[model samples]
Target: MKKRGGIRTAALALALSLSLSGCFFRGADELYAVPQPPKDYEALKVRLSEVIAAGGEYAAPLSGELIQTVQLQDLDGDGQKEAIAFFRFSSDEKPLKIYIFRQVGEEYEVLTVIEGAGTAINCVDYVQMDDEPYKEIVVSWQMSEQVHSLAAYSIGPGEVEELLRTDYNSYKLYDLDQDNQQELVVFRTPTDGPPQAELYDFHGVLGKTDTAPLSGGITAVADGGVQAGYLMDWVPALFAVSTYGGNGTITDIFTCRDGKLENITLDPDMGESRETVQFYTQVTGTDINNDGIMELPQPTPLVDYKITTATPNFWLIHWRQFDAQGEAHPVFTTYHNDRDGWYFILPETLGNNLTLARSDLPGGGERAVTFSYWEGDEAVEPKPFLTIYKLTGTNRVSRASLPGRFVLFPAEGLAGANDANTIYAAEFRDGWDCGLTEDEVRERFAIIKTDWLGNS
Candidate 1:
């Protein structure tokens, strides 16, 4: 939690082209081509080379096992959109890098990277800080030494900075006091150890952590931040942690000021297994409803986390998104089912009829907030579709094949946004790597000002 400085960023661009070879946006003709989503890897690489030749953008090296986190929010005040990217590299190394891109109209203009100060780190992020006018990105990173760190990145201008960094770690962000600003809540024990549930406030200043220990292990973390039209003055945050895993047993909840943990109900799967004296924990926090600006979900609320001993499945991993104001009635969840894959399950926000990509909304140059993804299977050939969806009274994802929704950047798997509609998605670079034009990557995806959620 701190204000950012441009000392590292202000000189990255000019000095980069001189020192680095073949940077994505550098003067090199051959660009570093990352794999693009929805395109065949072979073709994607080829196209990436071409796009690289076209645009000189280059991304820092990322480890294959690293989890990539990307989010789209118009960071700069100008209606154009930008991206916040976070990824890890060198499983042997502890430094985690976070990037911020500021797009001037269509091309990327400003970029900054966050170099992790601690140990080898693995991070998983969920953007929850809109409490500020700009987009706020938050995540928890486990240090190479086994310590967990929680931090937030607020995107603005062309630079990125650490809004908050906490040694005390938890699985979620919540607002204990109903002020709408989120908090950093977590529990930790030395390094590589089970954590208890604790609520924390993001004091932005480093080395400042307020802790209230719990009586027992944590279960699931949650809060009633949002209720029927009322943002609760004091959101009840819960954490489910126990000393053992399996058979599901009683969980505990901890408060910030008072170091007390209370026994709470937990999911049967959260119970202790045959392991004795060991603790299995699950944490999840919710604001469920965020009415655009006012609702900053879980100041650091905890939610059911996947920290089981069993093998983790990417397809089975899922999370939730809520409109500000609170995670009240209109909260939606990402459902990862065997048949449906991953979906935004919204019974409150989307009714029968939903509209996607309306260019005339009030913010920034009046462009639509376009959304796109692949509809085909990864194991087989790629079959991708682009569509748009508009929010409905009943809260549903009704789709429409909106025209001009895809902003095909000269690259694949790349996305850029300005404002809501003034957005661009880096398009397919089908095996055309090494040499291409910026105009070419620009041609990759169809730059459309159409709806974001499209017809299925």
Candidate 2:
């Protein structure tokens, strides 16, 4: 459990980014570990300036954290597509180290970076382990504001297992029984109300108090719940697409029998709540031209910053469409997106429910990217951007433009690099390798390459 097997956890994101700003004196005997962006931030800032000249000190290399969940598959069959990072290596106070790998061809090694919850600070995020199939990574940290801390790792090959360490928080991993595996849900705060989802099987010895149900708090992400959506095998019977907050929030899915957490299914009404979700994307429900009955489109409302307000301004974004038996509706949106409003309901047979395809980025406005995430004094960060759109016609959407200057990074303001977990421009294959379906990730992020419409 300690020495070189599974958990080591002690990452030095620029020596906790120069000791979380307070700065310090020589202490880099060796602790480079950097991973993010266009060749992992210039090869970890030139090997962290040679580990700060082998620890002599000059300073200025604290720029990490913007990975938001790793792993891309290819398994290793190798065609290309193996670059995992999962961020938050420093900027202390919480969000301790984590870092998985997959660069191969050019040296980005290091496939693990535990941190096993000592000073706590988790935030990993990932799901899809219904019983035992694949995907299963969760970090979730807080330990206060009503206690929140949980760990559950599971990436293999090079090795990475720890699985389970609850007290729960508002967690989510998805896939509540279409039978693909992937489940783990909680609402562990002070629990003044809704926020109770479960589906345990966390792996190995069973331990960690073990879990079972697949439905309990299908609601409670807070503010009266309303996340509703996501089931593409995020984890076995992993459903938690809320709508209310009364009994456990609006119900929809939730599997895992024998042990508890019921409510097997629901999703026909889908009425209220959207007064303020803000933005979110991810949809793929075939039927293509074959058109029989399938259409689930989402991901279009790029809000890097800037919002039109009549008075009522709301913000929340998240979606994972594909219903009508395809299962997956982890909805959440109240969006305004420069007055776009919102609506997401895919899986009709893809006859074109919406987002046939749309995009923007050839050159329009915002595109710096940094979704933000720190929590604990509650930062939430991430806000710079000018353009990012992808929405065909109907509900088809994708937007961007959040400029006020939208930049922050004193201690690391909008420091969250490139849409970590909240997803941004999904369904791409040539670079991330395999797994594409939201109509092949909106036709590979709606190729524009060189369009018109006020040309880019």
Candidate 3:
């Protein structure tokens, strides 16, 4: 949601001022004057049909078959809401009409008429561009083919002025810099090259931002307005763009700085390739560690390249945090593989109690990996566990489990630790008092291997 610290304050002040005036109040305890009834849809539709029938150059045939979409909002902030309607005259041609209607007592009056809008209307939203109590109307519509257009209009007493217009595929309104004013973030993807993202202020001025080129065309761009942490409070907005091709899928973070969109660099120690094991479709900014700074939660597929058999695919949730200098660092990652299905937990705290352990198969054979959780005092007898091992020289992955033991619960599939060629599990207890040590639990639970092998 767009931040409205200043807009809300102004609205409250306006309500108080109306209450102090001689306006009639419905109730004694009512803080503000009662608002007039909204314009009736049937009445507005009748007025639109009459106006279209009263032929003009802009008039078009109005049939019952044509699709009509209507929305009502107080575009001018006059306490009474206005109606905006879109009429589709033909599906084969790029001809559409948009009508704005105002309510004057029991009758509906035409405020503005926009002819030949486009083939179809995309969306309409009211956004505050400045300190004015009234908001500007933003309309995004399809112009032709893959081309889209966006227009912003300032609606006032019987006057409509177009404030801005541009070509865009998608756009969002957000207070990127947390300056109590919102900026427009527009994205455009060309058929010939990588996608372009632009930031524009309320005054329709474009940002002097620099964007890094990606060889593989851009596949997705996620909006990080709501999840933006402290860093977004300082910049205009935070966004993540994903590109794919010969270089694999690469995800980069971008934010506004010095009136320019700058790319954030990941810490070198986090490895050379920023691409994950699988393609990342979504990226959200969140405070995973509660450090006030925003962290990124990227979900990807989990796979072992050496395995050739049918291995079960699970999701791996990777957490990326940024330092003071805007360098990203990998914090923690984990996954769950229960018999039902695969699951990836986020925010760190949800999967913190789980751990993954690596151990050698009995007789010093192939190495194995297992996911376990701390059972604490609520331990179940004959604990069930699943392990994965690769056959020697075949590069085929196999799954084995201790027969007769119950399967590991989804909550117990958290990753523990892998060290000294050994996988260790932890114990979790309630009330901070289940008297059980990690070593004691490991000693009580003997590592037994069964000859039950199946294709992964």
Q: lDDT: which candidate is best? A: 3
- lDDT (Cα, tens digit) per residue for candidate 2, span 260-286: 555444322433222212122122222
Instruction: Indicate the worst ten consecutive residues by lDDT in candidate 3.
Output: 447-456
- lDDT of all predictions, in order shown? 0.35, 0.36, 0.46
Candidate 2 weakest ten by summed lDDT: 447-456
Q: Model 3, residue 36: what's the lDDT?
A: 38
The C-alpha TM-scores of every prediction are 0.37, 0.23, 0.54
Candidate 1 matches the true fold with a TM-score of 0.37
Q: Is candidate 2 or candidate 3 better by TM-score?
A: 3
What lDDT does candidate 1 reach at residue 414? 20
- Order the numbered candidates by lDDT, best leading: 3, 2, 1
